[model samples]
Target: MIREINFDGIVGPSHNYSGLSLGNLAATRNAGHVSRPRAAALQGIDKMRSNLALGLVQGLFVPQPRPAGEWLSDLGTTIEGADRHIAANAMSASSMWAANAATVSPSPDTADGKCHLTVANLKTMPHRSHEWPATLAQLRLAFAGDAFAVHGPVPPAFGDEGAANHMRLAPSHGEPGVEVFVFGVSGGPFPARQHVEASKAIARLHRLDPGRTIFAAQSEEAIAAGAFHNDVVAVANGPVLFAHEKAFADRDELVAQLSASLPHFELVEVPDAEVPLADAVKSYLFNAQLVTPPDGAMTLVAPTECRDTPSVASWIERHLASNGAIRQVNFVDVRQSMANGGGPACLRLRVQCDPADVDPRFLVDDAKLDRLAKVIGDRWPNEIASDEIQSQSLVGAVVQARAALLDALELSELG
Candidate 1:
């Protein structure tokens, strides 16, 4: 049977607020505030448990090494004498948002009948660029079988943000689907992150049918308003597309193209009259994780922030009132991650494959999740403020904590 599995990134022990991300509001607003690393990991783990409870398949990805040595070495700087910019980028735990993990094209959509994955170079931001190598390692390990083909990131000239800039809409998780690749030009004040060329390169590399892929430009206004990644404005599950009115540069044209391509296309547009784009960005209304479970209607797994925003809350009430596909909503508290500019959807990467085909060590069960939580609670730091990021004590602590986590997860090889 076809299954949709969510592989969530475990918050690293070095979780801290340095505000390194440019277009994320939470990152800027919460900069320098003290962060609770232990709590952050537990919160993410709890989210995994929540999904598993709903009978969905869940997987886990351990955080990449903190105070990334590779970045410092590239700039010919030592950790002890690193400047503020270098230090901030080194300590970035942004990889916890696995939605940017990689762009995935499942078996049914590829010509060779093998699932394909291409790591995102993430060259737009210095902090995120360091993630590809480490992410590639994990992708190779978890998807090591005849059923998969995992490729490295494209050349750095074209900036790619992975699944964050791509969405797939199919009749079922296992069927051949239409892939939407969203790209942004650099007219906005905020640096446009995903490049159109990069999206085209990935689509070509995956050997996807040219007719099955659609290329659309992101709105420059949306980018300036902090919709750095397309996920901030739109999301897709099965054949349903939920987005804000200003999500794309030309929403009508894009929807028309999708309808023409797919057998049955469903679009749920939140108009500017009811909720403005600014409010959607602030509340992460579209960033909420939308999942279709077995034997029931689709459910929206949203962050608690959505409920707190007046306009967003009203939209949710109206959506439920219609008794549409999104019949239920589960609000989760991932404030620690949210403060770093990621919501529930940001923490996970969706892949369609059979559970039995995956590496046993990478797959998660309730017992394994509980053990992982205990490890984070017992070893991860209580707090890490921005000012203390470069301190020697915090450095040692970050290193030791990661080692402990690797050991606890029986992944010492990765450590």
Candidate 2:
């Protein structure tokens, strides 16, 4: 049976989560070079892309829209565009903080085959007494079938209490049982204590064991050596807290520890590189967005730049390849970008996938599986095709289904 999953939207003031809202600052800094609308649009597009990609796989996309009062005036068109795209894809979408909604808490009960929306009031600091009932009502109306839960009124200390950001849930499939890891906050310039507290609260609600969670610690050694970001990324792979390099000797040490302790868990680590923040942001968002179920495997798609970084790509490839549980390794081609920071995994997020769907044997049977393999290859262009045809299962059916769907999406988007 397909288990139901529930997720909360990280509602905040800025489009990007966990980082400073550079929208206004970027505008002032590049006033002559770029327009405010263009800048906002770029960020908005990234946000929309992240949300939609997750929605496509997860079967639900819930976002706290720009605050209720500001929705029509500031974000109505964007919301409408997102709605249209989601509907076009035969997916469900809803806003937690739409104009008529109440305070953004008290998530609703789950409903079958529908998406839920739970809003958070971004205007209030340490928003202690918001009405969760109304929010719950909305969610109940939407996602009634899935397991539903609520997290936070993040404490005042995590960055700006009023800003919005999301917490990611990582689920892994084990042969005998399933394992789950929930990460509440990630990305650069970490948030304050309250944010971490809020994440802890959410993790508890989801039944994640606190003992197993990893916390992000600050280390001057990492910063001095310029390995801070990569260090944090490795720690963020866990469910409880963010990891820092100061806490360990290096990335390998951290990975080794995680491997020893949580042998079933997937460890995602970023490399130390000089890349545009936008691309980095996208990579983080993509990872969070593409979580597989507790019993399934996932493939990380990042740009060629990540591949070139021996410390980053080599480590990731080695981990996935050696790990008995990992199903596949695929690379994304981000060569189109002038800056060239992202790859396949960076651009897409996996919300949901049945373990039954992924077939490693498909890689080995390139010749006989050509037709189906072509469809899978096109959808996932970064994966290296193997010559051996280990399994011919579902090759024909998957190819046909994917081709038809791709054609339809192309026609609809073009129209």
Best by lDDT: 1
Q: Which parts of model 2 are misplaced by more than 4 Å?
A: 2-56, 60-142, 155-194, 204-232, 235-297, 303-415
Provide the lowest-lDDT 10-residue window in model 1: 185-194
What tens digits encode model 2's per-residue C-alpha lDDT throughout 1-415?
2322222221211111111112212212322221121222223223333333433222222222121223323434432343432211111011211211211111211122211232333322111113233344433433333333333333433331211223222332111111222223332443221134544443344444344443333233332322212211222222322232232334454455455555444544333343322333333322222333343454333444555654545555665677633344444332322121212222221212232332222111223223323333343222111211111232232233334423432322211
Q: List candidate 1 segments past 4 Å from native.
A: none
Q: TM-scores, in order shown?
A: 0.98, 0.40
What would you estimate as the lDDT of candidate 2?
A: 0.29
Tell me how far the alpha carbon of residue 406 in candidate 1 is from the true structure, in angstroms, after superposition.
1.3
Which 10 consecutive positions of candidate 2 have the poorest summed lDDT?
A: 87-96
